[model samples]
Target chain A: MNTSVNIAGVCFKNPVTTASGTFGSGKEYSEFFDLGRLGAVTVKGVATTEWKGNNCPRIAETYGGMLNSVGLQNPGVDYFIKNDIPFLRKYDTKIIVNICGHTVSEYCEVTERLSDEDIDLFELNISCPNVSAGGITFGTDAKMAETVVSEVKKYAKKPLIVKLTPNVTDITEIARAVVSGGADAVSLINTLKGMKIDINTRKAFLANKFGGLSGPAVKPVALRMVYEVNKAVDVPIIGMGGISNTEDALEFIMAGATMISVGTANFANPYATVEIVDGIKEYMEKNNIKDLSEIRGIIE
Target chain B: MKKFIFAEVVEIKHMIEDIYDMYVYAPEIAKNAKPGQFAEIYTGLGEAILPRPISFCEIIKEKGLIRFCFRVVGKGTKHFSEMKKGDKLRLLGPLGNGFEIPDAPQKSIVIGGGIGIPPLLELCKHLKGEVHVFLGTREEPILVEDFEKTGAIVHVCTENGCTGYHGYAITLVDELNIPADMIYSCGPKIMLKIVSDWAKKKNIRAQVSMEERMACGIGVCCGCAIKIQKKGEDDWHSLKVCKDGPVFWNDEVIW
Candidate 1:
């Protein structure tokens, strides 16, 4: 009956938390349900400075998913510490801040600024594909990913969980690299890069011409990556990419995700996170499963 | 307050070739919904994950019903068109800041283009004083009768010259030269820009509803961002159209 998970000495009440950028500091979704219901609330990416993001037409719907090139628009760490941290402190859940930057120093600057904040963890985002620099650039390369993680680790007082991009040729190699460079835990897979064209206009659908694809369409690939990364790295895996319902949640857990994040599905169903949380408990009870650890990575 | 509800389809009507009117029985949404606000209508298909954001055409509070008049633009809208009475679909609604109604009745001019004409019908019903409505369409016009029923002077314009006015609706508004205390509009970005410019020239305060490609109809996704400059501010900031406003004052928009 135990659903709690411990990631690098930080225990989440449950294994359910919102994916960054999708929940927006849990303000909009807070209208649907209580923020305390979930184990943790992962806020949007916070950069060293305010990001204007890309132009309009940033969102485009694909077959079983959606594409977005928001470019990690944020109000910076100072704004987040001043505004978001106080708001999240009212909740019972743990606070996991997702940090985004354009350079190694920029990443460390945010980490250093937030070191004294009352947050629980730092989700270093090197996987955002929409940005022109510093995001997926460091994520796709092992040496760069290792260097960023090790550099930011020096400034981050809280346990750092590096988010990995799926655009890399070998996801496990990057996973091993981050762990080697002092990443306490790892989360994967960030959106897969894809594009869509408007047939009538004969132009790209998204303003950025390409966007990170996330939703049910990317579930199978994400599950495979999570399983592979689980085997390759010793750190706990926070699996994501296209998780909507309880069945999807259980699959990722079986595939070796210590915790799961609800992403694009939140747009389709605002109550997706809480539903999966409740659904997971209901599933464990119905099957007479005592603890989540019994089934964690049971697939292999 | 906004809510998520499974609204039952009470009625459906095909008004024109691609446009259709759907009335849903949702007492909470009907009671809370205001003109210019929209609802995220979820398509039950797994393939299409995002909901279609449809604005309120009418809020029938007495009957606890809300009407959504939309055209079949893509896969999601097409699914809504095919829905029959008694079918229920998930809807998250009363989203975004609606149009602001002045306390004192003032002379107002409301303009809409194509599918954007629907939300104006509800705005006209709520507005007071001298109201002039200019509706523009590519070919044939719909909802002219509905606007006329609201006792507003309805002017129809078509691009093909097959209707009331020969040219665009804004051109007809210019030709009429009607004096107005305020102007309101919703349509294509190009048309909205023109309306904003025209209102500025006349020194009349104006509010225009905007549309952009959206993912999460709520504020979280930051998908539908519009550049807006607040009063007394030198720089324009990216404001979410889904949360900050689908309706904004013409002067505030960075266009």
Candidate 2:
């Protein structure tokens, strides 16, 4: 398979990257699938400070989906430096670290410290709603989104890709904000804030009361956001949210995304990412396509 | 170890004394599955998504089948108990980490309480030394023949004296009078705690498996985690059972 793709100044072995949080630490996934085959690996959202994250019933199962309120439970920046970073050292794939901060200093602090390490890129994630304040999710407000991108860009020696949320009223405007704020690229459509009611207890299913929703149901909303953002920004886009298979990944690329990430579906099938990667190669081969860039926006 | 799609429904009937006899369709779990390993069996085929995790019991590799004996507790199991011959089940398996069997033990006394006996059955099949198993369930709980087939001397415990020992399994463990070099146990929380505390006092090696709320059956989400201090200080570390372990050295496991 012609499995090579590029983003900004960086290159990936393939276009298949595991979604943050789902590929916890990366070693376990290696048990089922080879980590080196992936284009890049996204670590779980790392917070400036250690967070306990939401309460249990942290995850609840829906008809064909599940909701998780993990509350961004992380081993603080210091711990990540000690524990997580050392483990990623074994993998040869591009390492894109996702960072979350409750305040401005926290974001800068984490990025500044990480600046010393060998990393491929930085994903300024201002989309976690389960946090206190600085997680104001700059992605929701256009101006705030730009400011986060610009601030993190200061210490981030690597290319910056701002991960956006779908809870906003106008997603394109938010995309434009990050682009204007000097973002080298964009990753679209984080999970949507959703809740499920249990008929048994006559209450919310997730103990955290609410969680980010991702799966087939949110695919349309995700696609719409990616389409609008692809048109609004000149930077390359990484699209996500319920992208379970090759057709789904192709849809995002057609809608103007250069690369794609797989979330929620990784749970059902641990090898979902590799399957999508293989599926894409087969799709390209069958279609007689030589370059993935040729179909980046070839929407019929 | 490898993913194979071959699934078959094996009809197993207890030819022993009196017990529930029925056939169940189960996936091959223990071929490459380590001890303390488990699998999820869905009641129906079409996209129910959530499959209940059943600890892998004794395995019969020659027949390409494994067994998991469980008590019918709620809606899911009730549906399973009613399932008879020719019923197909979609199973996702070798799911969680299995028990880490140490190099060797001079002598090990295995303690099983009620439903906990199944996982231990798989572990005992690989033992080299003298192995003594003490099974605790209200005697004649369900399938006595299945327990006996594992080739371990089985001791039964029932509350009303319906079968063997007339008390909790812990009482049976006390009556066993077996010398323990290494002890491994699984079952109810109270039973595990009692064994964990007792083993700690005796300075014996022991490990316990814990069942907590699990969602994805993988480490994607941190749903099932217990606060265990990292073998040192008073500080507690949260470890996910789906990934970190369903098994831990008894002392290292913070109840």
Candidate 3:
């Protein structure tokens, strides 16, 4: 009956939380479901300054999934501390702030700014595929990943969860690097870099030419990476990527993730997070499983 | 507490080639629905992950019906065309900030092109002032009859000269020398830019409903962002098309 998960010293009421960028500070989804029902609300990425994001055609539909190059458009960390934090505080859930930037200083600056704010955790987004500079660069390179994580760890007051990008030669190598640099936990895999071309227009469907593919299409790869990283690192893993239902979440938990974040699935079903929460409870009751730890990483 | 619900399709009529008019019995949406508001309809197409945002073409409150006229632009819309009467579609809406009609204008100009014309009809039906409707299309017009029923003075333009004016809707607006105290428009981005520019020149107050590739018809995704001048500020701000507005004041838009 105990679904609470502990990552580092932070205790989530339940193992269910929304993936960053997918849930916009919990204000938007708060209409569909109560924020109090969620274990944590992972907000959109915030940078040093407001970002304009990318050009038009930012989203496209593919088989069983979708692609987006939103470029982490946000209103900056100051705005989050002022507007979004107060709004989210009204809810009875933990708040995990996702921080994105073009440089290590930008990431550290956001962390330092939010250090005084009423937040629970920090999901350092070094894996955004849309932005050309600090995003994918810090994620894909083991050395840069280690340096950024270590530097941000210095300023981040809350537990740091380094979100890893899947576009790499060895996902586990980068996973090990972040944990070595003092990361409390790890979340993976941020969308896979992919492209879609409009047949009639004879051009890229997305304005950015390449976008991160999420949803059912990337589930297998995300699972493989989570499994690989779980074996490679000692830190707790938050498995995500195409988790649409309770079964998908259980698969991630059994594959060695302490918790799972629902990303693209929230688009398909607005009440997806709540549904997964209820479904997991039902699954545990039906299976006569008392603790989530019993099934955590049970899959060999 | 979920905004999404299943609405039973009461009727579906083929208005023109690849264009159809659909009415769904959704009392909840009808009760609070306004002009320029759109609904994200689940197209039942298994491959299509996101819902299609269709503007409310007509809101029949007494009967609890909402009409939408859509063109078969892609696979998602094509699936909407295939749905039969009595079918049910899951829709989330009355979403976004809709058009704000001023108290009593001297006259209102409602300009619309292609699929964008549908939402303007509901606007025309609500306005108390003198309404002037200008519709432009590629070849055939979709809702000419509906626009006429709104009692608005209608002007039609077809690019092939198959109907009224032989060019864009602005051509007729120019030749006829129509005067407007207020304006509302929705259409292709290029046409909106042109109309937005025209409104700026004449010092007329105008509102436009913008469109973009949207994932969550609600504001979360940040997928449908449009550049807008922050209120009382010269700097541009990224506004979500699904949340802050699909309808924005002309001056606010960074056209």
All candidates in order of TM-score, best leading: 1, 3, 2
| TM-score for each candidate, following the candidate numbering | 0.99, 0.80, 0.98
Q: What's model 1's lDDT at A255?
A: 93
TM-score of 2: 0.80
* lDDT digits (tens) for residues B104-207 of candidate 2: 75577778877777788778877657766777775455445555665656667777787777887767777666777888888887889999888887788787
Best by TM-score: 1
What tens digits encode model 1's per-residue C-alpha lDDT throughout B1-255? Answer: 346799999999898989999999988888888999999899978888899999999999999999999999889999999999999988988888999999799999999999999999999999999999999999999899999999999999999999799899999999899999999999999999999999999999899999998898888898999999999998989999998999999999999
> How good is the docking of model 3, by CAPRI class?
medium
Enumerate residue pairs that collide in model 3: A1-A290
Q: Which candidate is the best by lDDT?
A: 1
lDDT tens digits by residue: candidate 3, B70-146: 99988888888878999999998888889998777569888998889999999988887788899999999768888
lDDT for residue A95 in candidate 3, whole number 0-100:
90
Whole-model Cα lDDT of every candidate shown, in order: 0.93, 0.74, 0.90
Give the clashing residue pairs of candidate 1, or none. Answer: A1-A290
Give the per-residue lDDT of model 2 (tens digit) for A33-59.
668778888988887777766656677
Of 1 and 2, the candidate ahead on DockQ is 1
Model 2: residues with Cα > 4 Å off, grouped in runs? A1-5, A48-55, A76-92, A132-138, A196-205, A298-300, B1-31, B40-46, B50-52, B61-64, B70-97, B100-117, B124-140, B148-183, B188-206, B215-220
Lowest summed lDDT window (length 10), candidate 1 chain B: B1-10
lDDT of 1 at A92: 96
